[model samples]
Target chain A: MANRVAVIGIGQTHHRSKREDVSIAGLVREAAQRALDDAGCTWADIDAVVVGKAPDMFEGIMMPEHYLAAALGAVGKPMFRVHTAGSVGGSTALVAAHLVAAGLHQRVLTVAFEKQSDSDAMWALSVPQPFSAPLLAGAGGYFAPIIRAYMRRSGAPNDVGMRVAVKDRLQALKNPYAHLHLPDISMKMVEESVLLWDPLHYLESCPSSDGAAAMVLGSEQAATVAESATGRRPAWVHGMAMRSEPTMFAGRDQVNPQAGRDCAKDVYAQAGITNPRAELDCAEVYVPFSWYEPMWLENLGFAAQGEGWKLTESGATALDGGDIPWNCSGGVLSSNPIGASGMLRFLEAALQVRGMAGEHQVEGARKALGHAYGGGAQFFAMWIVGSERPN
Target chain B: MSKIPATRQGHRPVAIVGFSQNHSVRSDSTSNEVEMLLPVIHDVFDRAGLTKDEIGFICSGSTDYLIGGPFSFVTALDAIGVWPPKSESHVEMDGAWALYEAFVRLQEGDLDTALVYGFGKSSLGDLDEIFNLQLDPYTMAPLHPDLVSLAALQARAVIDQGLGTEEDFARIAARSRRDAMNNPFAQIKRDDDVATLMSEPYLVSPLRRHCLPPISDGASAIILAAGEKAFDYAEHPAWITGIDHRIETHAFGARNLAVSTSTAKAGAIAGVGEGHVDVAELLTPFAHQELIVKAALGLADSVSINPSGGPLSANPLMSGGLNRLGEAAQAILDGRATRTVAHATGGPLLQQNLVCVLEGA
Candidate 1:
């Protein structure tokens, strides 16, 4: 096996409902270029480009990496595309890093994007099959029943969800690239927001935005080279893990998915993390809905079983002063471009460890966790990035 | 090559320990993707003398556009009974790419085995129209040119370039179809005269019906084991000595229609520079593309090509490419050849290409 790889560069675009100015190819390029620039390299400096996007229905284009390959300067190099639903972004990055960790490519460019404006996500996701439950109401609807189950089981205060929404929106104010930046976001605004999925209000749900996220992953040798070239330390990859379970299976525990827990456990073990709640400085987790923040907190072992709501109830997850400042660069709830959302969180965590998160930088952060789950929480991907090089 | 720029990490050399495929057909549309993969999945595990519980990772590739639904991969999981959960992933591309990802992931040392599968049913919609979705929507889909016409454009360009004649293209179809006679999974076969093919009417102007790959409906699965573990599974493993893939521009105008840059680059990167190849399976849905790929990969004229008749005989859209890889590996497993190369191509005008070099061990 090869030595550990590091995340040397990261960049993301301002996610919005529609980036009308740029084409889909350009949208991805924007992030890729920024990542390369941050790494102090050009397209020629990269080895391969691994990308991921949601269903082609969103863009009405098939396997778009082929067309965009030249645009990304992947003409003479290996190029790949991955799709695992919402987790695609995280999975794409993980796959790219594996190439580096496995001693394949030195400087890999992995990007994930979605131009949701080109087509309706709801329609694309709701294309009814012969005998499947119609996703007529979009992703939030399918997840709401599970959310209700968590509410009933945990008996957490209703305020927990509202608090998470307010916190993430406030965090978005600090992130210039985040969508849904409410200058004066409050709990009332969230309460007054129209209800889409019952028990999940509009403000509580994630926004469907067009955006892209990119990262340049490197092996140990490339890491040293990048550090010397950019005058910046690399965020070493400590651990990564992914898991999936079939949807609609009998006794499929959607409320507290086993795959999610198992993935976190595996990553934590690999990272030598005995106590995620205290060992890690912060995390950037996929929480499209507010309640998911605490839910995932517990799932990731950041909090004890059924007691994650307490962490949210306390001011323990905020950037001002918290044991674990989650989503300091805003998260999936604040800005989402489906395919790229997970990678954005991942890249943000790397940024924090690299001390390049600008206004949302977590002070003295050394280790951070980036997490994302998709396919009705049946798919999970997470990585640990640290300030120090990992063996 | 020590200073070779833009290279990714190397994964543990993985081997094809076991494989199972459905009887290729033309009208498997009625059977859902999950249903088609059910027996095949079990058969692959049985062939490997293992169980799903032993497989470390499960990755699949297929296009949602083929099924006209988003998250097609999610629904297809029922076939494998992924209920207890497993390390899994899916790619929107062909299963060939999925194998690449799994091959790389196997480098983690934690996973000694991986399962990769792909399936597609092209009978639900008119294949020509459905394929348009593979093109850029705003610029290409709106124009709605079918694959046959697009391929004809390439075919015409290749002919104009004086690379191959229309007769040469017909011979490829004739030869592959005739060879496909013994392939139980092939969708079409014929030993008709090359002159007869030349006399046939054009499906698209300048391209005869025989030149096109028959629309196919099928699913395929292959088992991969890494390092020493591969020996425990198969007595003679088809070891993937080298594998690489690259992409070309999507805009037909930007890419050279007569040549496949991606294939050539991937071939060189995949160590086609190494020892001689005994057999080669080229994923050329169109007849002329076989010659194009053969030239790009620099395969020796003495090498046997697509002994399973190639994609010109049966094309399953998303899964076709991986089938090519499996076909070549089967040759190695059967001791028919000591070394072979398999190539898979995707996207319009052959925008994406993957090359896998398999060696018997």
Candidate 2:
């Protein structure tokens, strides 16, 4: 097995609520082409391809990987479709990494995408079948209560969420490919927005964007080849881990899921770090909802229990002066393609580690963490990357 | 037992350490995916003899459109019964791909054991037309090219190539349905013959009801243990020593409809090179597809095929692939065979293929 694998290239599309102009295949191809160009390679350079999306119903396609295989430049090769709920983006990357980590393939192209515009997600997610009572209307409706619980338990002020929304929107201005560019977005705009899911204002949530994200992942040899072609140092993978528990069982804490914590601890342990807040230079954590920033801050053990909201309130997570800038690329709230949201975080983290984040770059970032969670926070995929090689 | 003295070269390596499957039926009247999976999920945990706490990772595969729902896996967590959570992920694919995902995770050395499963109930709506959504929505779906016609095209291609006659196909259909008489989980079992099946007529030219896999409503699970933990799970766990998957293009015009190159490549990687397959459980929805896959995998003439009736007996969409592994594992468990190879195919003309070789090592 290869001792180390790195991300040599990353590309993502402009996310939006609807992509009527392009087909699903075209949407994914846009990102894939950019990734290949960024890696300074062509389709033939890729040994395998792994694609991930939320569900078949989201687009009313029953396992559409077959149709999508050709679109992603995967004609006659190993193409895998991974669906791990909302965490599929992260899962796809981890799966690609495994191909390298297991000494199986050298350069693998991983893509995750979603076109919510193709069908009604709410209708697709909530199909009243023969048995069981309907939960909330859709995913947001289902998770709203959990967000409310976090607020009540932690006594977080409502303005904390508003502030997060404003900060992320401002940051999105720097990212050309972000879907939501609320140039005029501010705390006042968020505060005045209608509460769709109690405390979750319309402005506080991620838009259902039609987009894709792709990355060229390679083993040591592949990365070396890329470095010569692209004239860039690839982000060195330091440590990675994935964990999962049941969705909802007895004594389940949706507010602070154990799976997220276990995933964080495992990756940190592998990276040989005791204090996450002190050890990492920057992090691109999944934050679809503004409140998730603080919620995940606590779950990842970056802040003391019940003190995550304080980090957000104190402005310690800003890209300019904060100790650990979370989502310097604006995160899910600013640009979301449901299936690719997790990969965006991972890609952004790689961008920071490779010293190529442009205007949003965290200065002198030597090490970074990419984190994502999905399916009511039951799944987690985390990776630590650094400029220096692991011993 | 036939004293073949199983040579290691003839036996591929892969095993069923953990197995879980939900109840099978035409339709599941459930609120969410979580509820449907809750019950039988324990079987995999129990059969693998590992607690949820011990599982290093979790990978699942399922189609969202199966139940007319999107992000089905997102809500399926209600059944996973996770609280305080665990490290887990999902794949938008068949359980076979989920197994592939779990396999990759195992190689990461983060965890040696993983839980992988896939579920789908093709009863929620017009599954055949719904599958049209899998095509290029703008170009192919508007044309409403049903899945049956596509398979019929492949079958017709085979006929054009003189691969097999329609009579041969009818015999395969009759044999599979007849074999289903023994499988309790088979939904389309009938005491009928090829003559009756042929007389009934065609849903599409060169294809009949018997020639098609029933719109099965089912779920399946498999536990994957890496290295040493695999042995501790079961007395003779189906250790996955050789497993690989590959894909072809989706464009109908571009692909050769008569054979499965992906399966050939995957089988070669899975060490099908010199092995004498004892029981080959093939997931071929169409009879002609069975022949195509058989030729692709290069199975010997004497090898027993579809011992558990196969997909023609009862094809259950997403779970069908895992069901093939289960059937192969059951054979090993019964001591009827020491080695077997199970195969699964997805998409039109078998665009994707997964090969799992198992033995009582």
Candidate 3:
């Protein structure tokens, strides 16, 4: 039988536009140290390390893991690097989980981060290709047109995107680690903000952040030790799935990507989730842009294709009233560290199940979903975690 | 006071079913990354007697710095036409690590067949400057030490330690190139005398031009199947008995440059000494490092090393490691060897190492 795995420890650096206080190694070490402290384990206890990040160009490094081996306490141990664009963090976590699940390692430390302050992401992302049209503007310029297509296809009201922008920020006020603390955030403020990507406003976009996220995943036996040591339950992993498609193809639906749908379906099947909307206590879905909240709601099978926006319109996805609250920790809209953003979702989900989310805790949450998508929405990774171990 | 004793868990048997690669080129300006991968992917799939959909998972390895573009692997997915979406992953390291990821994923028993591939166009950027960025940014990268200079430091340490000399480096390079004559895909093939090669101008002190691997543009692919399905694909599957990788400290000065502790550790865990090794394919970027790896792996004079010429004949950044595994498996399939060990190294000066032991029943 395969070994059962659990998220024994979770930690994150205080997300900000620029972490000038630390170097890349220092930034990751902060998160790794915190996670190790949480798990009551030293670096020597870890059997292996798996690190993930976006493009090496973002930090002007080739394979940063090599240089970081000593700082990460990965010397004389196995260290692997995962890269799948924005989904890298989620993928990295899943890989670490597999190391435990497969009984290859007793305890694994996984870290994901992006120090955007080290270099310009927009410039790095827009490097022209040989036989393709150049991406002149940043991610917004490319995603704005897709947002327009969603609005036209679903006949969504213009304010749906604005509402998500406001709701996520309001939740951010309660999250101390969140980069943005918009106490006065409102639809009016989002509407009045400059339209950087036509359909999306400046306030609606995710901020560029320099931060790192780390998790200590262990085999079931290690989890027992961790629980006894910390007096906290481990977040038992239920199921995980990853899917990918080509970046471009004729008639490909960019609005609700099939890859995202398939990934959620596979993971849901593994976790025995029939109706995600009613089953999952909460969700930490990647919503870099506010409008993605509803779009992903539909793509992830939370609601019908056109009904996704209606859920947001009913204020049902908000932290105060909604049963199936999404991104209660303000999500990517609050803190976007590119590579670390997805793992932040995974960490936040684990926090919810462990009853350690503090201010953003979903009351009595038993299970939660963590989701992320990357590239031209061609890559998707998702996992379900429960307070109780799965049979 | 109870704990689960540390044990190697979930040993799901898997085998390399198919392997393929394109001819290593110094610069093939006509084809882009995807175009270069299309034929190799098809060749491997066809060789394995499986279709694209038959693959339960797809994992790739490549770096953006090699191509000077982010998400290069994204467009490369087009070569497979993933309309219905496929389980996939990518690593920023060599393809061998991608193989390692897939190997771990297969152990879950939920997936059986996986396609692993890696490609890089080293001709695109100033590789020396780019590789320097892999160093510790705060301390080492600022110095801009080129790869040759770093390898020279390792070579100098080897000579100083009395483990090997400049002539030994020349002999390894000469033998590697001579062996490349049998490898149609190898980039550099020559049969020259070690003494004559030693007389050539040194690119870096104690390192002649032949001591370094060619900066080649290439792609490599392998198809892996688990358990019974492994025998279904190949008559003599290269059964992966053991595979393990380990890394050492990045502070090269703190490491014993004459020896590779990581490779030795990986080899020990991979059971390299448990069986009589018939053939070995080691990924050594510099010639002197070959001697270091051989000693680390504990290969005796009976072992046939680099029958496929190895990385010294043609080193593609991301694909070089996978190519070594492929070459070793090919040796097993070709009736040349029944048991083989393959090694891959990453980071500056063999800081990280992966070892895989394959055998035939």
Candidate 4:
């Protein structure tokens, strides 16, 4: 039988447009050191380290993990790098969790980061390839058509996205680590922002920040010891799932990606969640654009098709009074470091389940979901965590 | 103090039941990355007597930098014809690490079978200029030191430390390429002697062109089955008795360049010393690295190393490590050896190393 696993520590660097003060290694060390401290253990306690990131082009460093091993105290230790596009951070954590769940290691450290200031992601992403039409658009250009398709299909009001942009920025006021703390954020402000992509305003898009997120995953035995040592509860992992599909094919639904749906189903089955909106007290989902909030709501089975926009417009996802609050730590919309975005969501979910999400905490949030998607909506990873161990 | 856990005992037995690879070439213009992968994917699935749906999990290894595009692995999934969506994951590292992930995933016992594949087209771009980006951005990358120059530095260290001379590198190159004559998939095959290779011009100080691997386009796939399924997939399955990987600091200047401490540690954990190795496949990008890696693994002269020519004949960047593991497993299935050790390396100067011990049942 697989061993039970728990997240004993969580740490993240303050999201910012540029981390000019630290080298890439220093940037990651900031989070890893904090994670080690929170775990009440040293690097010696970690049996392995797994690092994840988006395209190396984002930082102009191919396999930066090689240079970072020394700083992460991974020398003479097993180190693995995961890259599944934007979802890499979540997958990286899942890989680390597997080590503990398989009884192969007692404690595992996982970190994901993106140093976007090192290089221009737009140019790197626009590079022409052989035999394929060039996609000169940055990520926004590619997703704009999809957003337009969603608007046409759902008949959602244009203000729905503006509402999300305003709500998330308000949530960021409570998160000290969030990159964009717009104290004066409002729906009118979002409407006044320039349209970076069709149907998506500048305020709706995620910021390109430089940041890192780290977590210490421990086996059940190690978690018990850590809980006693730290005088805090560990977030027990209830389920983990990953799914993938071809980027382009006939009948492929990019709006409601099958991969994301299957991934959610797999994780929910493991967590024994029959109704996601009711069972999952809150969620931290990958929503780089404000419109993705409703899109993912339907894909995650939180709301029925075409009705997901109703949940967003009704103020049900707001951190202050929403029943199933989403992205209470401001989410990717407010602060995104590309590669670290997925991990930040996963970390935020763990924080909520453990009641460590201080100002952004959902009252009595006992169960939470962390979700991520990447590669043209083709790859998905998700996990469910709770305050109590699963039966 | 080395903190490697003592190799665990009495684990679920997993075996490499099927393996396939494409013909290595200087540049395969006829086939794109997906085209190169389809045949090998089908071959492995057919050899395992399974279909796409039967495989419980799939994993792949590749990097976007190789092809100068993002999400290369995303399109490659089309080769598998994923209609219902599949349980899968990917790594930025070499396919050997992909195998490692699958190995760990299979250990969870939720899945019984997995398919792993890796591919790279080194001919896509100027690798020498492209590889410079792999260095430490704040330190080494700014220097614009290409990969050959870096390997030359390691070669200089080997000679300076009296580990080996230029003649030894020539001998390794000669032996490896000559062995390639027997490998139909090898990109570079010649029976040239060490004396002939010694007369060649130096690509870098103390290293000749022959010492480096060819810029090849290739892909490899493997099918892994755990427990009783291993028996159902293959007649003589190459059971993975032990496997482990370790990495060292990237500051190559701070460490002994002539030694691979990471490989040595991984070899010990993989139990490479426990049994007699009849054959070994080492992923050595440079000819001189063969000596450094052999020493690290504690392989004896009697061991038949690189019987299939190895990376010196054809080195496909992301898939090279997994190919080494596949070649060793193939030898076991072919009745060439009862026990074999396979080693794979990544990063500069063999900074990262993985070792696996396979035994025939």
RMSD of each: 3.0, 3.2, 3.0, 2.9
| DockQ, computed on Cα atoms, for candidate 3 | 0.77
Positional deviation of B244 in candidate 1, in angstroms? Answer: 1.1
Quote the lDDT for B119 in model 1: 90
Question: Of the candidates numbered 1 and 4, which has the greater TM-score value?
Answer: 4
How many steric clashes does model 1 contain? 14
Q: Tell me the deviation in Å of residue A101 in model 3.
A: 1.2
TM-score of chain B of 3: 0.97
Fnat per predicted structure, each in turn: 0.80, 0.79, 0.85, 0.84
For model 1 chain B, the run of ten residues with the poorest summed lDDT: B1-10
Docking class of 4: medium
Which ranges in model 4 have alpha carbons more than 4 Å from their true place?
B1-9
- Best-performing candidate as measured by DockQ: 4
- lDDT of each residue in A181-287, candidate 1, tens digit only: 99888999999999888788899999999999999998888888888998998899999888998876888788889899889889988899999878899999999
lDDT of 1 by residue, B1-361 (tens): 2111112224466888887888778888568888888988999899888989888999998988777888889878878887567889898888999899889888768789999999988776787777777777668888989778899999998898888998998999998999999898887877889999999988886789988888888889999998778878887788887888888777888777889888998898787757789989999999989888998998888888988988988988778888988889888777888788999987787778999888885
For model 4, report DockQ. 0.78
lDDT of 2 by residue, B94-185 (tens): 77877777676666555677777778777777966777777766667778888889889999999999988787788888878778788787
Better of 2 and 3 by DockQ: 3
Candidate by candidate, in order, the iRMS in Å equals: 1.5, 2.8, 1.1, 1.0
The Cα error of candidate 3 at residue B212, in Å, is 0.9
Clashing pairs in 3: none
